[model samples]
Target: MTSARRTVHGTTIGIIVLDTAFERLPGDIAHAETWPFPVQFRVVRGVRPADVIEGDASLALAAFHEAIDDLVSLGARAITTSCGFLAAVQDELTRYSPVPFFASALLQIPLIERSLPAGRRVGLVVSDANALQERHFRNVGAEPGLPIAELPADGPIRANMRDNAQQVDRAAQERDALETVERLLAAHPDVGAIVLECANLPPYSDAIARRFGLPVYDIVTLVTWLHNALVPPRYRV
Candidate 1:
């Protein structure tokens, strides 16, 4: 009788992607070239970006499970999502996934908090403040009322992204991101580090880091760190 074991290969990271038609640039986590190591991408069909961000996660949970199963079948050792808002579903997804699962970049908040001095908080830059909830923080071990700044939903950046416009106004998006960061700092001057809560924000990370001279954490940083653990480099004599 032939053995029924699953055949696994080289890919180490499995990215759970949203069902969106937007253009993903090089820095975007969903972009293949974004990572140095090989990765497998599984798009959770029917789970729109807003569905994860603005709606309850019960409906999207099944989509995540199905995607994770496909990625594992393709030999992914670890899993992560393309949206920080998915942190709301982190517990459920992690429970369903057999491999190590990091559902959102917001999972880095608690660790980043420890690095800051007393009374200094991590400032968050997210796609929408009104949509971010206590459950999103609780699932990721983050405290409720974490200082946050939301990108204007009515602005060109959100409009372009939400509509999946063919041409993204990079300059406009950058301006809005920067303005939000500035506002956050103005409100919370004790913010020691800034975290970009939206996966789409890493494209502007360097600019934000340069303008503020603070450590900026995003999905790229979180996933790269997770990838290192999932596939540590082999030492050759």
Candidate 2:
């Protein structure tokens, strides 16, 4: 019989991650580990941005599709990609896959917007502002030109976060992220909710919420919701 045909008390959710050497940046992996349901992972090798401006999405989709097939074979009930940029092909990916799939954390934008009153808006904290465009915003049912903020993943800022992930300077990384969120909120007072664009930032979700006094949404939360609905704990064996 097929893997999908086999029933278990719990269901597995597959996460497709980027091919990066960084081990501590496994936000998706960490999220899956903490999930209430069973989780499986399938990595796609060697997919990265070249010039920052020029992205090879075709290569990304190829890796993603291959990973999906493997996960389905392993009996994954649903799939979620690790990065927000993957939303570019979310519609296509979901259409092609037999299982439920979520491509981006920004998918929560529409729900967030609907929950809030007018004048108050959701803010996006992205690793790369230039890469986030109207296409991504609209995909999640967010208005174009919504309050968005970006912090480049470079310089001492990124270095601090990276070092913290390695356990070299945890305090420094926390401080840097806190400062960045403070600055972002100062710049956009009307932002009622915050969406963390970088998967790495979700670790500081509590900090961000406390500092800004707003609901914070990240890829982790999005995956958790999808996992719960698509693969409930009772369904896992």
Candidate 3:
């Protein structure tokens, strides 16, 4: 076993990502790139939702394990996946590796839910509502019947947002996000916080928080929490 002292700051982090063709999506990968820490990442190419769920679940686990092992070989202390939808395999992935692993940003839901007051609720803003399940919410410790908003899944809008990167039309994304939040808040007026389920939504977090006048959580914030927890500066050698 690697001694605790040997594993301290010598640890790196690996991020397993899908092989999407889009180049401008500035999600967690971007955050990891600029993270002010000594971490490394390895992308496990060619893994997609359809292949993982329909082709073979074990294949997905195999790919995830392969990436984790590669990172571990390079001295990674922990692992994190790029997409929230991967939370389904959180348990299985962790079982195959000894290092600390975070399945998705939504993993912060349990903490967010606990911090809210009674009658108030936590809401999720995701790119695709159809892909989300009650299990995803439950895995994160959210109460059943929690409100959620799906951004316009239209191809053109998504394509435009992805292509622009940080230059993405703030007004457009905020309009869509705000419309969804407004609709949810109208129905569930007690919701006190909003969680951005899509990692790409962080660039617009401040606007969403300012417009809704509520706390907003996104992958950037969630990853920051994970970074602090698993790789604290004090832990660095």
Candidate 4:
């Protein structure tokens, strides 16, 4: 007698969600309706935003592993997370996943670096500069010396994410984002493009791009590229 094997039929991507209670705008990865293709989501219950930003691997690794098992069993061709800050434990997650896993949008940093001209840089907008350390960059194979800016500590944007507020002020968030980008460009005038390190920021990507006149990269762009690779479209040429 042959043993039965479990399989998921159509889903190509699985997303491990953090235990958050904030409003997820359209472009944010946590919003299930954001993806065009069908996806499976498993909330790593108890894994909060602070845990992803500053907690030790031991705090979240077990939940991540369990989520990977669930997603893989469901036939997910690739796995990704809803939080970009999880880049801190990416190596551990990759070690546990049987399929391709993109733990953070920061994973695209190295590829972005390759596109830059000599002396030009990529500006990084993160949730908190204090939480993003040297190891986070190293985990994603990104070089050091990348200029970074953080969301204002006292702004509505940070309030929504860090405090897990029930409401988000889009107008206020855009104001803070635009101001931050301007400061970043002023400080690092040679920045060729901007990379948003927080997955929740993509909803405002266009606004930032219009204000700064630079390309913006975020989790949506990275995951879309990865999804294309996992399930390439067939064209009758």
Candidate 5:
């Protein structure tokens, strides 16, 4: 048991990804190139995109726990999921996790809000506005009524993501993303920072920040923070 505790080494972060067939771009969490450090990924096979997003994740709890145990044995010290909507299962999964677990980028909402000046609030850009509920926020300890924007599922970009298309139109995705941000800003001008609730949305983060000049947060930022904490940079002091 001792010798087999860790079959791998030097990898600190383990990612739990859903069964997705969609194209994962360079900034997407599931894309290995997205991370600067090494990470181990365990896909909870048979768990589909719509199942986790629109349906209850309770049915997949057993599979999730199994994945956690598997990753831990593989030398992963921290774990995170590829889906942002999985925040609904945050408490349950964190308790079951052997290591620190971050269920969603939405978890950063509270801390980001606290950092904001008065009258300003952190805005959210989620994959499906209609599917996100109050419980997802409560599970992650974020305010329930915060301003949120959604990339309309009816649009070609989000539809492909929801349906898990093997390929995606990058140009159309970018245009839709910027338009979504425009709508969000129009509705709530007091939005201080924007948080992307879709793991695949990170590719457009830089574009959002460049156009709106607001700080954007996503799975990449969350994972990087977790990795840095687990493996701090060495300094010759």
Candidate 6:
């Protein structure tokens, strides 16, 4: 609710969050500073990270819808979530939301794929490679066969998410993220662009892009696009 943000981006964006206890570093969607525009967050009650990744978020459909209602009531023009695994429920939640609902950064896959050169395709860096299912891509309108990678489970990035730790080891995170991107690129030479499916991965987006020399897209970009559509800047003609 900063006046500075209001002057630049008029409306508020709502973020549906999972119930967890992790330090959200700058650039993480849950971190308020990650957004240039103002945002409102609603934690879907009792919905944990496991529920999102393991359950595919289908079990919490009604809860997510309820959160959307609350946010819409609070003047939120668009809605998004803190977890990329929410892509599993993207189709249904989008249909149920009163306003625009961007459930996951994975939403960028289809567009990125189509935007890439003929021989290149979009590659994904996800939080849990094992948890990703075909339905996640299908629900977001992304075609199957796109390559994917995961943060090392033992690394600070994945460890913090798993333990919901408040302290972050940033250097370690960057290293792990960079290595993950290297693996993704090495495995898929035709990858023209990189899409981070996990909302937390934006913190390392710049590093990934710099190291891999590929355009990286995440929730931040997706939300910025929505923010622009909802409240375009005024230009003095």
Best by TM-score: 5
Residue-by-residue lDDT tens digits, candidate 2, 1-237: 533354333546877766544434334344454555677766677664331214746556667788998888777878886677676677778888999888788888889988987888888877677787777766666677877777646634355433433333444545666777777778888888888876666767777788768899998888778866764566556
Clashing pairs in 5: none
Highest lDDT: give the candidate number.
5
Q: Per-residue lDDT of 196-224 in model 6, one digit per residue for the tens?
A: 98888898999888887899999999999
TM-score of each: 0.94, 0.83, 0.79, 0.94, 0.96, 0.93
- In model 4, pairs of residues that clash are none
State the local distance difference test value for candidate 3.
Answer: 0.68
User: Candidate 1, which segments miss by more than 4 Å at Cα?
Assistant: 1-8, 234-237
lDDT at position 62, candidate 6: 89
Worst 10-residue lDDT window for candidate 4 reads: 2-11
Residue pairs in collision within model 1: none
Q: Where is model 6 more than 4 Å wrong at Cα?
A: 1-11
RMSD of each: 2.0, 3.9, 4.3, 1.8, 1.4, 4.1
Put down candidate 1 lDDT per residue, 140-228, tens digits, no spaces.
99998888999998877678779987777788888988999999999999999999988988988999999999999999999889887
Q: RMSD (Cα, Å) of candidate 6?
A: 4.1
lDDT, candidate 4, residue 136? 88
Q: What TM-score does candidate 1 get on C-alpha atoms?
A: 0.94
Extract clashing residue pairs from model 2: 8-237, 9-235, 9-236, 9-237, 10-235, 10-236, 10-237
Task: Please give the lDDT score at residue 77 for candidate 1.
Answer: 82
lDDT of 6 at 237: 100
Ranking by TM-score: 5, 4, 1, 6, 2, 3
Question: In model 1, how large is the Cα lDDT of residue 103?
Answer: 79
